[model samples]
Target: GRKGDEFAYSHVVARAFDTDHHQLRISSARLHDALQGAVAAMSEPMVSHDAVAFYLLSEEVSRHVKVVQSGQGADEVFAGYHWYPPLAGVDGDDAGATLDAYAGAFFDRAHGGVCDLLAPEWRLDHDASRALVAEHLSRPGAGTAVDRALRLDTQVMLVDDPVKRVDNMTMAWGLEARVPFLDHELVELAAACPPELKLASGGKGVLKEAARRIIPAEVIDRPKGYFPVPALSHLQGAELDLVADALHDPAAKERGLFAAGAVEALLRAPNDALTPLGGNTCWQLGLLELWLQAQGVR
Candidate 1:
């Protein structure tokens, strides 16, 4: 315990973490209410409501501490996300083609499959989105696939999603969130390490080994995790009614924010009760309505 405590105090003591289990549930209890408006306010629809809701919920507890540390940049810099592995594109060795394969996987995975339910005109083409990724890939940076994935994420996702969400939500409640993993000196050093060393036999192998020396092997040996969330449970009662009203409302359907028939099809499926698209699409459309109503768009 001394060695573990000593190592943590010396190395990871930037700020204390908030880990009160009961407080966590109470904080996130209103996720549905928050997202109903927050989602509508976003410029893009693809941002994950589940993730953002938790980020906002964390801020609720983080308010007590005033300042808290976050493991924000670790995955982006260390190739920690399972999706960071590289794949071969149709045109082997062609940099642009290679990037297409890389960016395509990201788009398909992160964008949620709800595009199929969009009113034809609302579907995302990603010509514009692809261009953004293509531009990032073409930039001068690390050459390996894993390295490129890290490089691309550092420039794009690191700040856009993780860092931005934390900052926005926490600051809304006067909480300050610090990211030690994004240290300039550490990032510089991490970039120079061989790509294989980063994603070697396992993703984040180097980071995990360094952690192994100080922390128990069992603690650092676990598989990657997406924070567990009870999305279906959170949608029960008035929350479910909100989604139903948003999806089945004849007036809202006339405004053309969603394909009502398609969405209702999802709501009606007995086997698909817990489907991801069912929740994601409804949340997006519901939020859009809240935002529109707030701005007098309707």
Candidate 2:
């Protein structure tokens, strides 16, 4: 729990289990200080926003524990994302439709939008992201559109993004994390379960039902909560300054990854310019520049 930003429902479960619970609260200043360290820890750049929270949380957790179990692969293995439902009744053989649906729901921005953001020289001639998705979808074993989407997410996106974020952040503090849902046997079982079963109860239905037996209904039935980090989400004060600095730096201008006009527009309205996925676009762009500079890539 992170003080004012805590999910009240989590506290309910803690009380029910009578588990030793500890909470960590972070200030905007402390979070800003940890940002560079979080970026440095990652093997590659990620714009997942919650990475800093994981970094700070892991630092605190290491004081008490060496290794901890995390629920990392549950969503991918169990089909818990909002994108799963529309693909539910889609024809198994319609690979194009499946790729379109998945791209519509998950890609941060469309290819045209990405082209607009990048310098002309940096823009790709084709939808490389879609090509990547299509390659994964064509792979053997997955039976239906939803199955392909699940397989793609579980095998590709989850490994690179959330799992990597957790690994990098946790290991930064000498803390080891075990993702039980990713155990080979469990993943295989989850992969084999009918998509309909996993998509029920508003997604992850099977897991929710199983959880009902042990945990309180409130925790199981409530809306999925992403770890909150408000300071980064709606940047202001020193946090906003940090992002502005990175995007405007000499190295960023020399590299010219983003179009000058696009970068300027984001700086003008940092809070308003968001990606289709609701990410702060300024932060995403700035973080890339920051990470590159940190790595001495320039």
Candidate 3:
């Protein structure tokens, strides 16, 4: 109606089944497969599989539908990847040390690059610099550096990160979803596994090797590309201005999700021009405004 066109299309959507950071690159093929599967399932009378297929299909059809499914938890359950493998012939302790050293060296190089790019006023001394580097390297769990890294990702990424995009989009379309990955039982099982077994040198060492017999190696071994939405690109121009306006507007201040003066400062600050807050931040602000509006709080 907006475009004054008459057309009907079917969409088949799938959740992020893999844990790869770059979901776009990882899930492209899988998404295609899902859409094909949905279309095929639709042609036949609704079987049990079709029921699942159609639910996912409806999500695809909606302008902004977020389906909360638990593909990540399933991976962890069946030992699907994300387990850090020990380097060949290295003792557990040594393997941990090797990873830590590698991380530290990488951090130092990255810090140097960032420092070179930053203004002179932002520069810090060696101790401060190393501390900042350590903050980036540190993770949530106790144990080796690699273990901690895995824990951090599991805690922050797999558990909580999905909500940022998924919940927002789903709610935007007036849908509610429950993710099974947040299941306590599944997370406990995955967390109980020894790191050596999980991160074996050959990629999700144990899980991948085990799954090869059940699922084709091609399917299991396919490179993972997670949600690859060009979020930043989507949030530019009018969208960015809308966000900026909401943040700085007196009416937004009266609504009071944020401190009016602080929001104004953020808007007026020069940093937004040079290093604009990315789409995630903009989306979050928009969602907050939407929620406030719904509650009649603003």
Alpha-carbon RMSD, each predicted model: 6.5, 1.8, 12.9
Residue lDDT tens for model 2, 244-279: 999888998999999769988988888897788778
Return the lDDT, model 1, position 232.
Answer: 34
Candidate 3: list runs displaced more than 4 Å.
Answer: 1-69, 74-142, 149-159, 163-186, 201-203, 231-234, 253-298
lDDT ranking of the models: 2, 1, 3
| Off by more than 4 A, model 2 | 1-4
How do the predictions measure up, each by TM-score?
A: 0.73, 0.96, 0.43
Q: Which ten residues in a row have the lowest lDDT in candidate 3?
A: 4-13
Q: Relative to the unseen true structure, what is the C-alpha lDDT of residue 153 in candidate 3, on a scale of 0 to 100?
A: 49
Answer with 1 or 2, whichever has the higher lDDT.
Answer: 2
Model 1: lowest-lDDT 10 consecutive positions = 1-10
**Highest lDDT: which candidate?**
2
Residues 1-298, candidate 1, lDDT per residue (tens digit)?
A: 0010123332332233333333244334466556544544344433354455555565566656788787889888987765666542133336676676676556643433456557767777665666777777766655666666678899888888778766766665667889998999999989988766777645777888787656655446654544434453244456556667765566566767555477677555412433333234444555556555545565
Model 1 residue 184 lDDT? 97
